[model samples]
Target: MEETSKLQAEAKPMIYPSNGKAKEALINEKQPEVRPVRGSALRQVLVAFVANIGTINTGMVFGFSAVAIPQMQMPNSTLPIDEDQASWIASLSSISTPIGCLLSGWMMDALGRRVALLLVEVPLLVGWLLIATAHNLPLLYAGRLFVGFGSGLVGAPARVYTAEATQPHLRGMLSALASLGVSFGVLLMYALGAALPSWRHGAGVSAAVPLVALVLAAVAAPETPSWLIAHGRPKEARCSLARLRGDVCDIDGELDQLTRGTSISAGDGKSRSDMAASKRQTEKPEPLIKTLFKKSSLWPLGILVAYFVIYQFSGVNAVTFYAVEVIRAAGIGGGDSDYLTAVAMGVVRLAATAAACILMRRMGRRPLTLISSIGCGVTMLGLAGSLAYLEPGDFSILSWLPIVCIFGFTITSTLGYLVVPWVMIGEVYPARVRGTLGGLTTCAAHLSVFAVVKTFPYLQHLLTRPGAFCFYGCVSLLGSIFFATLLPETKGRTLQEIEDYFTGVTPTLGPPKENKKKIKSKELNGSVPV
Candidate 1:
């Protein structure tokens, strides 16, 4: 209670808009030129873009198997694969992604966000190059593992950085931008798969993306102010916040808010014993078991685990890794191969994600997720029904029905379950455990992906297409109910507010509320600002 009150008191200077007038009055006396700055939001976008550019490569890492595995199955192909080998090839990256997620969690806090962002490109570049030149199963396996590891490394830092750097109003859009980058990357790979003669050439071309992301991170991205302050570098934190917010924002006041929000104290005039106690408190690490059991850590982790399980088992990844196979099974192209249809589905997913970025700015996370979950369930069931009943030579009549269901599944999944989980990853956890818990959440998610992707073929064989999709539909519907019950609405809430809700410091997870007592007290004193 004492800690929460201290945090609230520290946060009061910046959480409400009343401070704006005082800051404006102070700025007016200094310089008129610095009073207004345009495009602060644009600066936030630039940082977000840099942080997430690597996700495009992560997308390609996922989409690669969808395109590459089909090509490897060709009879005349130089590197051919049987069914077992193909499943391994398709699911290998997912197997190694958890390792990357675990490592980046430590590195995001131990090293820095910028360093993690920059270093992830190394494994990605090496992996793609290995795949491009691979001639055997071992080499292909090695490449996929490396790519998956790099993909894991990206989730923590990109979302964490974007969440900490941007303001509350712009945070959703920027954080969702990571998902948008992924959608674009998947679309790019699908188009490349359709156009390129060989998967090897596509791998070669994909190497350039991480290289570009590396350069962007090195040249443009700033270390998040929250990180800098937490690490005891207030000066750098001020500068970073300045760079992210531009001249119009009150960098000092925002920094103070950030300090309070992150639960770090300034320690201004404390005695030697007090300072020593504070140092001991902050430096002493909690046991992993205890940390995991804490309400702050446990609650958000539960939410994420439930959300990610739904995300993977709902067959989004099954469809992603096996787009061509799904399309073929749907009887599209009259029993012929069709990469273009996969590319078109990619286009639809990309467009839907783009819309999600806009809608995330306006809608609550819970509603969007519920809508997406329900939509995905309906689409999957629809596809199952269409696949079960459609007869041969019915291409002219209801052939497009299965395709429409598939497209509908893609659209609905992308809007909420696919994107919201990632956004919430950066939002829900408290700063003390954000890195560790974020990594674990991401690690668990990829493990689920691995299970889904690896077992997809077996599931299909055992149950047939309609039965498998029917299972997925049922799971998705149940998942919607789970999310609807527990998922708190996080739209327009600050990170501190969200953290407080999870910790039970506050009863609600809505937007920050003004201190009405303070305003009333000031009004009684006749000193309240107009």
Candidate 2:
């Protein structure tokens, strides 16, 4: 009885707004009513599928370079590419990716989530259409560049939209769709590359993919409730949440949390800090540029950027993009049979990524990531040793070694390295800065792709193919150590909870009466916070 009396005495009203209008809205306005779905997974699936469509388009475009490079170098090619041109063709996508990423953040925030995704579809369609009809290298390069732009654009939106739209239970698997879509797209392109008469024919047919994504996104998908609320449309946020939940009651709790934590350091009185510290942190709005430079913000960015750097530098791109060459160098098939090997590798990647979707929810992010990095490191090193130590011509018995190594790299890399970085990128940041950081991370990812792809030939020349694999193995092993030590466990927490962790706030707290009374007294004193 005394505890209840003390708790009531200690309770204090917190004024969340800095201005009169917001204060009036919170105090006087009633929440809009809406219905929600109970135990229905449809809304989650639809949003994920819509976001996945953009990723699929991105994947197809990315995979386009891998298969089309071979055809462009063939004799009688309409736009035959030289060694230098082929390298550029492979690397050009990386060059244009950051531009796309920049646009993605703008479109997502300025226009809308749906609008940003629609923008992704248009460039992919046009890029492929141009590729199909192009008679010269310039047109071909331009088309490839456009496809890359579309791909880069999808990266930011996919992470932001999926994270915003789905519940915490589904976040890991759904967000993983971003990476999975890319894997499937690569698989799709490989399938088409094998079955079609030519690369041009395959690309021409693949243009239909984004066209479908465009229609579905325009007609069916809804903007996320979180995005709507952040943009100051609470009524719309309610409506979207209702549709997303579909007959579930009491959705207001989540809606309220979403509204409160819209910024990076949402300094409501519930935080672990003292009332003075809370007031000081939220007193003045931090500028975006200033926020980017702060140690707290920069630390997460560093982790995300390094994750992607490790993902690309683990030699995944070098192995996948130059699969045929690697196999040939290792004395697999004499001529073009390595194309078949590339296709098989794509299937393996798709399957492994799909498996990761299920396993991530059960086992959590950190464990799977550690396993993937270490496993890939070991496989790449084995490939290196076999190539460096054995004579290709004399060791006919070990011709299968390269195939085994490539398959091993594909399976191990996809299990964690290919998928987990995107998942972490989605989960680790505050919503206020998610779009900006996402763009920066995407830029880092593509830049690394360019770096590894452009330099692989040189590295192979300097250290031989075996030594190149050895170097990549070293990178993978080092990355594994970082993953084990640095990454946080975010398997089942809500977005608001994750954001609080970054802000040094605990998800759960119990305030002592003395501390609560002290805070209440501070607020009642009415001094302007610094």
Candidate 3:
């Protein structure tokens, strides 16, 4: 036991990159560490954000169901579908997302981030075209399947790209852009669906989004330097870093950190022959089942799994997939009122996500999530009460109340729970297994999403709408408490700092002093203060 303890205490951090020669050159101590300018680093983030348009295409695809379903069921429409088909349409994206995640992991590792993302656009573009031209149900289903595959695949590379490409300080805010892009995509369709004469009439428009993404990804985006280094292309890695560094030709400290895992102090000059004998000896990664149990890996995987459970059960999918049904059930008839309300909610979610840029920076992640979870619980309970107590006739007079509560929930969820988990997913893991772990967690989360979306009608049938909401409310309330007790603050810190927190190492960068004091004081008060 003492020997085990001593061994643990004496352990050294592993090197991250696979380039044998670069590893030796990377540790050269004669070089001075260049502190990358915050202003310059912020600009590098723009490339990742532009490529994130692919993520927006995902939201557009899901939003298509919201608008297309009713049109597909129209009496005079060319391809009206039954309730079963509509349900299948809504749930298929979730079904294929997991499969896409698994395959995307391999593609990301094999093809590189930029090329893998470009590959993602191929199916999404073709799928939209198939959707645009389809006259029969099979073609429509096949198109949806392809789009689902792309959506599922996009998450890992998008995450890996943003996480690897951005400076550690800008990581959280930039990562939030993925979800923000998703909201924008959803909002575009929400507005477009309401404006277009018919869903089928959206020709030459819907496919434009992914095509733009494809073009931008190919022309504007840079390959991640870390991926380049891992593949033994240090010259390309150096070039990628120089580009990301903005007007700088020399690779900075961040590049060394990437290649070596931990930051290394400069070593004295060594003979070129000494460096020549170096060879990379990275161990083969374990299988996914065994990978799940590592101390560093387990926290992120377990928490994300729980987060998805709480997230999906928050009724986001149900609310989005059946916004019209929800309003109609609340005694408002399906028509202009329902679509307008959904657009309003979509706007709310988008606006809140935009605001999250500031909130996450100001309040930090744990606080935002706690606030979001608790507020979601409260709003959901209010929705349940509104449904249970309000008379059908009285809905005309007080019809706006439920919308207000939903807006409130949107404010809360988007501020924290909706986007932060994803940000952490990008931030929390070691780069060695990041792709594999990313795929697995995303797949699991989407599977939960599928289960929740498919069961919405059944859940409503079993508990009634009000009862279903009450269940979500109670679950959210519990989720808030769980976060309060356990979720670590991740905002404003580097990925290394967050990993250190999970691994029980002293965090290299702690929160600002005022923020730390505020967090502790809030915890002492028995609430996770936001």
Candidate 4:
């Protein structure tokens, strides 16, 4: 333990490319240590507001493609397209996410969050421009692919930025804000699709929102302090800490904590000279894949993947994609049925996710997830019953019942499942492996989405609507069981604390065993508490 303390004391921080540049700039300025400003609450709110713009932009682009596919079909119009070709417009975007995630992980580590975000925004702007002026099928597909790539790039960084910027206690609530942004974006898309007569206009409007968000993100957002520290710009990292916390009373202490918390000591059998040389020459190792294989990480990864798979398997994409067909099958006669259901689901999701923002902090993650999983399962079963038993053209019972089930599923989903799983992925891993592991888990989640969205129509045709819902119901129940058995509670714990829990490492809650001597001296000298 004494040896470990000495090594930690001598440890040098890792520096990324941007950190060196920032330090060079700071040398010429001679800036004072940045003090935390007043009105931290207001600043936090503003940061969340700006960060959510990225989330909203992502959802808007995703939702627009769903709304556009049927309109682009244009029945009997002889555009020389088949179902698979139309489906590619949406699938291409989903497939691009893993690639974008891999790239974003590298960029976030190298360039800092703000610059990485700017890179994502550039693609979105160009993609939206292409989408707005898409004259043919190829251009439309290209536009969708670019937009999807941009959205995927934003996902990991947006979460990382939001989580790193907030206080420990506030992390869950603030992190859930990204989900709220997605909900609102989806709602906006549904509303626009209903309100507009032309699909082109809806696509154009979707393209415009992200272009506007790109401008806002570029001008206003600050780089994450954690990213700053990782790059070796300790002074700028301190300034960023001050800006986010808005308090100076314990700024140095807080910085010390953050620095110590993130630092990784070189392993046994390495002399200090060798370690120092290694640090100077080598990049920070990416341990993400190896970490995922650990017994500690494997269970969480499984639970999270199951959560994502089940969430998608709830027939969300199938329903969203075929809302018009489902409504008609349910005996709803109006042409507006699809739009109405889409708008309703979006509204309910927004409200439920907003409620989750409040409840997740208060109620904790597990209970909310359990309730959502069970609720969605039961609701799906009910929908299957309605589909199987309801007589044809029984509009009163058929129309309202399925609509209620859809709303129930959407509401339950937002309350815990979708956003919380992503937040847990960010929280569970060590900083060394967080990005890569998170990306891998996210890839699994999204690949399930791609599979479901692409195949659900075929499944429905093969098994009928009732049979598909029954399958969804069974999968949801299994997910609930998985959550009950495997998912750990993460509320109110620091990242280190959560890491310790997963790794089966018992944390010293009080002073270190060897710190007793220092503790006595500090008390004798009237120094502040450790």
Candidate 5:
């Protein structure tokens, strides 16, 4: 093990700057730039573009029910399903998400982020094709499962890759960009669903976008340099870093940091032995799972779970999936009403997400989350009140109220739940278990989604639509309080700084200074150890 570690370290490129000094010398020579280079910015944009395609695809699945519901309710239609059975089509996607999450998490750790991402396209393409071609319930269910699997597989790796690649200072903004992509995708799907003549056509069109995204990702996306360094391939790491950083930017200092973090020293053990030990340890990895149960990790996890429950139960999914039905139940007329409401909700969600990106850095994570939660709770209460008092036949009052409430819900969701939870999950965990933990949390959240989507129709049937929404409002209230108390403020902090904050350690915010006398003494002693 020791010999292998030494050899791996020795194989690393030992590049000295033209100024004839170590790279750290250059870092200490000036303050680090606040802004990233053009290449890094471009990479951020690309990551956002790819990552949000999954969200858009998920939205497409949700919107499918809107189209399917009408078909199921039609007088002469031969579809063998009621509203409850039809809801299963959407719920099936959520159920499949957790399975994909578990698989992708392990695969990402074993393979690499790029490989995990590329694999997702397989399920995604197949799912879309199935949905596009299906004439029966069984094929439709199979297609939705595939789409869910592909989206889940892509989620964690995309976030981890984007977070690892960008400078820490720009992390929030870049993360927000990914969220914006989700909003953009949702909006696009909503618009397409509204404009298209048939559900299958809409599904096909949505499927085509991800196919394009898959090709672009395969062709242009660079493998994360951090992953290469972790696997003891420093030369390859350097090349990947160069490709990501571009020609003019110097990556030697960043490379050193990556090496220092991942290096297995002679005193540590052999690389192969460490790998074996790691494999064995992970084979029965209790500590990794237990970390989420620790006091330090628990609050963050609770906050995430609470946020997701609120986000799902706050009736956003209900509206997104059944907007037209709800609007019709309120006595609004027109076959296009559902699609129109969906498009409007998507627009509001996009706007709200944009507002969140602008405000998140300034207000900090906790404050914005608190505000959004409280706002959503209030809006939900209003929705519940309007639903309860207004009779079904009162078209004048009932028609616009549901639409307004749905819009309110979308805006609040954008501000608080939709994007912030994802950003927090990416930020809060320790580097060693970040990917695994994030995937686990996402699985838990989606399980909640599975419950809500599957049971919502039944719940509405059992206790009118007003009762279902009222229950959601109460959940939103509890979630608001939980988030206000538990989540920490994470606005301008670096990744290392955020890690230190969670673990109760002080981070070194800047490079240490060299004392002139100490340096002279070291020079006289003929060497200095860093």
Candidate 6:
């Protein structure tokens, strides 16, 4: 402890970056040593905010079909879409999203996370513009495809950026903010869908969000320190770290730890630089396929892929893409009230996601997900039961059951299943192949979404609404078992620590290990604190 204090007392203020370049400063030995201060949580939040702004546009893309499909199906509509075309319009984005995820994975590795985010504006703007002016089926299909591709591109980078940039204490909340942005965007679209005269106007207005995201990414956000260090730009990493941490804290220790990588321990024979040099000299670069097949990659990949399958088939995309139809099937409201209820659901989701940001830090991941999954199962089963057994005139008295169930499911799912997986996608993977694995997981996710959303209409026809609800409910309960048995708690752990767990090495240079018992407890039985 005394030696730790001495080290802390000897620390110096970090040099902040300016105009994308870090200004270097020499330390004066005669000057008094400065102790490290806590990092600025405010700057962390700002960077998180900027990184995730594009998610709002993502929300708009998903919700657009909800409004547009109903509008296009109306009598005397110009671009009349039958059920098949409408399903294509909604599901095409999922098909194209995997392409975007692959591109994002490669770009995040090659160009950097910030650059990947900035480049996404091109697809988003073009897609929204196409949707705004589209006059025919093919044009509309093309527009939705473009928007889905852009939406896919935005997700991984934003989550990865927040995870890498912020301190661990703030990581969960900041990372969860990405989902908050998506919820707000969905709400914004729902409002626009109700208030605007046409879906075209809504699509036109939605383009403005990506433009703002571009400006924020270009002007306000810095490249993540992890990316800079991985690319051998240690100086730039230090600068970016300094800026994110603000002038109050000494970043030298953190910077050195980052440079050393996660493998360093007390008895390590060689430094990280020596290891890198030896590997470069002795071996060929490992093929991407080999990397993908590694235990570290496959373990997390399997969990995420299965979780995403649960998330999509649990009726999330079905609710999101076809909210009006689902609500109508619930038989509570008529006409404009259904849109009003959709907006209300959006508001609930946004608020619940905000609560999740707080709860994530307080309640941890495992418990909230368990609670959420169980709640989803209960609510969905309740909805199905009510739909199945209730007499037609009985709706007059128990009229609130369907809508209540819908809202309950929305709240429950948003709290954990919808939001936490996105956070895990950013946190659980090893940094060496984070971009590739993240994209694959995201690709898997969207593919599941495509399958679920595209087949939902058919499922409703074949199984009927009650049967469909029963299917989703059963899936949610079964998924809770996965959460219980397989999922690891990531709350309060640094991204590096989480990665270390998957790699099966004790993290010697990461966050404090006082919480080892907590992590162990979480893993053993998936228990949460009271």
Quick one: best lDDT, which candidate? 1
Tens digits of per-residue lDDT, candidate 1, 286-333, equal: 665576679988999999988999979999999998988888888776
lDDT of 6 by residue, 366-465 (tens): 8888987899999999999888977665646677888889999999999998788898888888776888888888888889989999999999899998
lDDT, ranked from best to worst: 1, 6, 2, 3, 4, 5
Q: Which stretches of candidate 6 lie over 4 Å from their true place?
A: 1-34, 263-289, 507-530
Backbone-clash count (model 2):
7
lDDT of 1 at 338: 72
Error of 2 at 97 (Å): 0.4
Q: What TM-score number comes out for model 1?
A: 0.86
Clashing pairs in 1: none
Residue range with the least summed lDDT across 10 consecutive positions in model 2: 521-530
- The weakest ten consecutive residues by lDDT in model 1 span 262-271
Task: List the lowest-lDDT window of 10 residues for candidate 3.
Answer: 271-280
Candidate number with the higher lDDT (4 or 5) = 4
Candidate lDDT (C-alpha), each: 0.84, 0.76, 0.74, 0.70, 0.68, 0.83
Candidate 4 CA-lDDT value:
0.70
Superposed Cα deviation of residue 65, candidate 6 (Å): 1.3
Count of residue pairs whose backbone atoms collide, per candidate: 0, 7, 3, 2, 3, 0
Candidate 5, clashing residue pairs? 1-269, 1-270, 2-270
| Per-model C-alpha RMSD | 9.7, 10.4, 12.5, 11.6, 10.2, 9.6
Clashing pairs in 4: 15-231, 16-231
Selected candidate, larger TM-score, 2 vs 3: 2
What is the clash count of model 3?
3
Better of 3 and 6 by TM-score: 6
Q: Between the candidate structures 3 and 5, which one is better when assessed by TM-score?
A: 3
Q: Clash pairs of candidate 2?
A: 36-246, 36-247, 36-248, 37-245, 37-246, 37-247, 37-248
